[model samples]
Target: MSKLFSITLSLLLLFQSFNLDMIDVAQLDDFLIHAQFHKQKYGDNLFVFISKHYGELKTQHDLEHREEQKDHEELPFNHQTCSHFSAAFVLSGADFTIPKTPQLADTLSNFFYQESYCHMENSDIFQPPKVA
Candidate 1:
C-alpha cells in the first residue's frame, strides 16, 4: 500500500513538473524554431529579450489563473504562435515533525507497593482471628 501511494504521488509530481496538460508537441517545436529566429526578428545584437511580448503561450489560460499571477494570461498571445515554457521541478520536504516517545517506568517496582494494613485496634473487622 505504501509503495503504491509513493508511486501515485511520484506520477502526480512528474506530470505537474512537466506541465503535461499545458503541452503540445507541435506547438513546442514551432516555439523552438521561432525562438531560434528571434535574432533575425529583433535585429539589435540582442543577447536576450526578456519582454512579456517575446515568449509565452499563445492560448488563453482558463485554469492557470486561479493561484498563479493573472499577468501570465494578460501577456500578448499573438506575439508567439506557439507555447514556450521552461521545465522546472521543485522538491521540498525538509519540515517534518518527530513524535515524542512516551516516558515509561523501567520495572514493575515503580510504585513502591500496594499499602495493606493487617493489624486492627478492635480486631472486629473480620470478626475472627487474623494472620500477619
Candidate 2:
C-alpha cells in the first residue's frame, strides 16, 4: 500500500479502538434533549457534540468556579448547567446518528469549520484552486 493509504488505515484502526466505550442509546436520547435545549438557548454560538462524561465534568466545574469567582461576594450559582451523563448529538437527523466518540472530534471540527466559513462567505477555505 502507498504511504498515505497506510496512514489512513492506521488512523481508522486507532479511532475504532478509541470508541469502544460508546454512549448507549438511552444516553444518546438524553443528550439529544439537552443539546436541543443548548441550541435553542445559545443559538448558533455553541458547538454541539458528544464528549467523555468525566472529561467534561472538569471543564464544567472550572466554568462554574470562574463564574463564582467573578461574583466573589455572591452565592454565584443560581442554576444547574452540567448533567451527570454524556452524549453526542444527532447531526444529520433524529433517525440516523452516531455516538459522539473522541474519534469523531476531527470530523466534527472540520464540519464546523466549513459551516462557519459558509456563514462568513468564505467557503474557499476548504476548496482547491480551479485548474487553468
Candidate 3:
C-alpha cells in the first residue's frame, strides 16, 4: 500500500509540472504575437534582424560573465552595444529595409529587449532564435 501511494504521488507531481509548463508556453505564445505585430508594423524582416542581434548580445553577456568569474572582477559593460549592433545589421542587410525613423528604431529595440527579458525571467527551456 505504501509503494502504491508513492507511485500515485509521483504521478500527481509530474502532471502538475506538465500543466505549469503548458501555462508558460501559452504566455510565450502571447509574447510572440506582440513580437509579430511589431515586425509587421515596422518591416517583415525586422524580426530576423532583432533576433540575430539578440543572440549576439546574449553570447556577449555569457562571455563577459565567464571572464568576470575567471578574473574575479567586473568588466565594464557597453551601454550602447545593442544600438550600435542593430544599426550595423540594418545597414548590412539589403534584402529588406528597416525604417530609418528614430521612433521606429527605438520601438523595435524596446520590443526586442522586453521579449528577451521575459524569456530569461520566465522560462528554463532555451528558446531558439526565431526568424520571421
Show where candidate 3 strays beyond 4 Å. Answer: 1-20, 44-54, 57-132
Model number with the top lDDT: 1
lDDT of 2: 0.47
- lDDT digits (tens) for residues 1-132 of candidate 1: 999999999998997676554444335554444445555764523234223224343223224334323433333232334568999986676766699999996776656767787586656775876699
Q: Each model's number of backbone clashes?
A: 0, 0, 0
Task: List, residue by residue over 1-132, the lDDT tens digit for candidate 2.
Answer: 699999999987986565422333235555555446545754522233222122354366446556434322222122234446878876665576577856544443433333433464457766778999
Residue 72 Cα positional deviation in candidate 1, in Å, after optimal superposition: 14
Q: lDDT for each of the candidates?
A: 0.50, 0.47, 0.48
Off by more than 4 A, model 2: 1-16, 44-62, 65-132
Better of 1 and 3 by TM-score: 1
- Candidate 3 — what's its lDDT? 0.48
lDDT-better candidate, 1 vs 2: 1
Task: Write candidate 3's Cα lDDT for 17-116 as tens digits.
Answer: 5544444444555445544654676464645534423445446534645633432121112123222333433456556857785554444343333343
Q: What's the distance in Å from true for residue 112, model 3?
A: 90
